[model samples]
Every structure is written in C-alpha cells, then in structure tokens.
Target chain A: MIPTLQVFLIVSAALFSAGLLAALSRRHAIFILIGIEMMLAAANLNFIAFWRFNPQSQPPTGVMIAIFSIAIAAAEAAVGLALVIAEF
Target chain B: MSSAAFVLIAILTLAAALAAATLQKLMHATLSFAVALVGVAAFFFLLGAEFVGLVLVFVYIGAVAVLIVFTILLTRRDVGKDRGANWSGALLAVAVFGGLGWAVFKTQSVAIAAPHIRALTVKRIGEALMTSYVWPLQCVGLLLTAALIGALVLVMEEKR
Candidate 1:
C-alpha cells in the first residue's frame, strides 16, 4: 500500500531534525555543509510528497522545483567548499 | 508493499543522516552523507519523479559529494580531530526539532482530499521547462556560471 501524506511529512520532519542536529552539533565546516544539504533534501522531499498527493491535476512543478533545487545546491556546494579551502 | 519500501528507505535515510552528523572521521561522514543522498534519490523514485530522482543521484552523489571529499583532502590539515558533540549545539537542535514536531502535530487535524495519481512523463516536463519555466531556468544557469567563476577566483593563488 502507498504511504499516507502524513507518513511522508513525518519522515521529512525527522530528516530535517537530523539535519539540524548535524548542522548545529558539528564543528567541521564541511560537515556543517552536509547538514545543510540534508535540510535541502528534506525540503525537496516535502515538495515531491505534496506534488504526489495533491488532488488537482497540477503541472510537473514539483519535479521542476526539485531539479532547480538540486542545481542550486550543487552551486552552493562548489562555492562553499571553495570558500572553506580559501580560509584554510 | 510500497509502504514497506518507504519505511525501509526512511530508516536507511535517517540512519545515514545520523551517521553523517555524528561520525568522528570526516571521510566517514562524507560517505554517510552520500548514502543519505542516495536514499533521498530513492525517495524521489518512490514518488514516481524519475527525472528528478536521477538528477539527484547524478548531481548530488556524483558531483557534490566528490567535491566535498576533494575539499576535505585539500584542507586536511585544517580539519581538526572530532571533538564530539557540543551541548549547546545539541540543545539548539532539540529546540528546533521540538518546534517542528509541534507544527506537524498541529497540522494533523486538518483533513485533505485523496490525491489523484497520474503519470508525469519527461516530455511534459521538458515542454514546461522550455516554456513556462524558461526564465527561471536561465536564471539558474546564470547562477551556476557565477558560482563556477566565483569558486575559481576564490581558489586562485596570488602570484608574486
């Protein structure tokens, strides 16, 4: 059986919490960046879940948003790591 | 069956995320993060977002994870030994989680209609991206180019 929307939302929340723990608790800059990535992933999951469960015959907006999010995330990582290296 | 698959994926994702957060070695943490990313890709697949799922794997696991590992290697000397979790950080995380949990519970009372499932083909997505989303797509491309140039400049050495 397919999981309910609540199930997806709860899982997203858990992942977001885990990401928060990682981002806040970690000392290393790279690990902190990883935490940020996790947070983004959680948000993406929420978007996809909503898209999948929405009653309207919506366009593929959620997938498009996910794609844009991934691209932006890649850019963020590239710049973030570069800054970390420069500081080091 | 799908629910079971979701549960498995959720467990795997959460475990990897926790490992990535709490691990002592940076390398191990990076690997764990990669696993977590893969689990997320699987989630996209479960939601029938095939293109997005593949993109997540290709961009996140293939590119970003590798970049992070490379950065760790280059800055090895700066990555001090794992100092364990800080109480202040833990407290902050807990507080954020608590707030989020409360929000989740609060929203549970509202009822939503049953979703209508339909196939979302790649062709439709492509058309939409080329038309309705074209401007935002161009902006994202510009952002990527700027980020690339910025990274190059940041890493460039000053010649004497």
Candidate 2:
C-alpha cells in the first residue's frame, strides 16, 4: 500500500512545474516570491523521497539537508520580503 | 491504503499549488500557497521524516507564510492591482515541465529497490546535528541571524 519512489517523484515534479509556472507568470513581487518558495519545497520533497527510498543504510543526510533548506528558506523569505517592502 | 492517502495528498498539494500560481488576488494566492505548504509538510510526514515534517510546518507555515502576508498588508496600496499572467512565462514553464518529465520517464526503467524503513527519532536527528552536522548547523544559524539583522536594516525608516 505504501507509495513507491516513482509516485513521490512524479508529485514533486508536478509541484515543481506548478511553481515554475507561478514564478514565471506572476507579475506581483510577492506572488513571485511564493512561487520561489514552492520551488524550494518541491526540491525538499525530492530530497526526502530519495532519502526514504535509497537502499543503503546511510546517515540522516537527507533529513539534515531538508532542515537546512527550510532554515535558509525562512531567511530568504524574511530578506526578500523586506526588500520588497523597502522597494515600495 | 497508503497509496490512496498519497494520491489524495498529492491532489490537494497540486490543486493548491495551481491556485496559488493562477489566482489573480494576492491574498488568495498567499492562502493557496499556505495550503500547498501544508500539503508539502504532510508529504514529509508520510515519507516517515517526522522531524523535517514538523520543521516544515513550524518554519514554512508558521513563519514564512505569515511574513509574506505581513509584507503584503504593509504594501497593500502599492500592490493593489493584479496583473494578468504572462504568456511567455507559461510557455517557459511548459517547456521546463516537458523536459523534466521526459528525463524522469527515461530513467524510470532503472529498478531501485525499496529501502527498509527505519525508525527516525528526533533524538537521533538532534545527535546528528550536534555531532557530524555541527559546522553546517552553526553556519545556518549565523546565516539566519545575519538575514534577520539585514532585513531589519533594510526596512528601517530614515528621517529627512
């Protein structure tokens, strides 16, 4: 019953595509930022999926990377929004 | 059962993402983006990454999304008008998706065996972060602190 790696990959791909569409299509600065965040989320999902499905008994590198990605994303949002606000 | 759960979550995620991308209103798009973020967090949970899932919720949904909303509110008058989607951008997105999909399908034939599910406790993650990942952890902390300070400086009002 568990979803396979392919399923996760496809979902992430779709997410990435949607994000790309948003990023490229949106005219508002904030919407563009949201799209960028979605893209980051898509990449994070891929990392987690690959980590989950990897056959090797490895360290929790993928999870750690995801954690760092979230942190960086938070930072990016803060700075990006501040810049957006300052521009106004 | 689990596949069904995944399909449902995937549908929710993609739908929210589509709405976020296509919505004309900034507020509505932000809300949809929040839903998409929550969906991604749910995905992390389903993948057995409990710690990451919680962080995704805490950091993304709680902090980032709120920050975005706050920014929008602050600059509401400036960004009141919503513009239509750019056709060129849509075309680019479609091209990128097609290329990526083709790549994925081409490599789909490689049989990657399912990994055994191990219980990943928060304690183990903490241990790893403090031990092997200490350098990166410290670096990220520094980066976040710098970003906070920089944002504050950027938004500070100047007197005439």
List the DockQ of the predictions in order.
0.69, 0.74
Worst 10 residues of 2 chain B by lDDT: B108-117
Per-residue CA lDDT of model 2 for A2-61, tens digit only, reads: 677766777888899889988998778888899999999999999998888876535889
| Best model per DockQ | 2
Candidate 1 wrongly placed segments (more than 4 Å) = B78-80, B109-114, B158-160
Q: TM-score of predicted model 2?
A: 0.95
Residue pairs with backbone atoms closer than 3 Å in model 1 (clashes):
A1-B1
Candidate 1 local lDDT, B18-85, one digit each (tens): 88888889899889999998999999898888888898999998999999989888887946457777
User: RMSD in Å for candidate 2, one decimal?
Assistant: 1.6
Q: Tell me how much of the true interface, by contacts, candidate 1 captures.
A: 0.74
What lDDT score belongs to each candidate, Candidate 1 first?
0.85, 0.87
Alpha carbon deviation, residue A72, candidate 2 (Å)? 0.2
TM-score of model 1 (first chain only): 0.93
Best by lDDT: 2
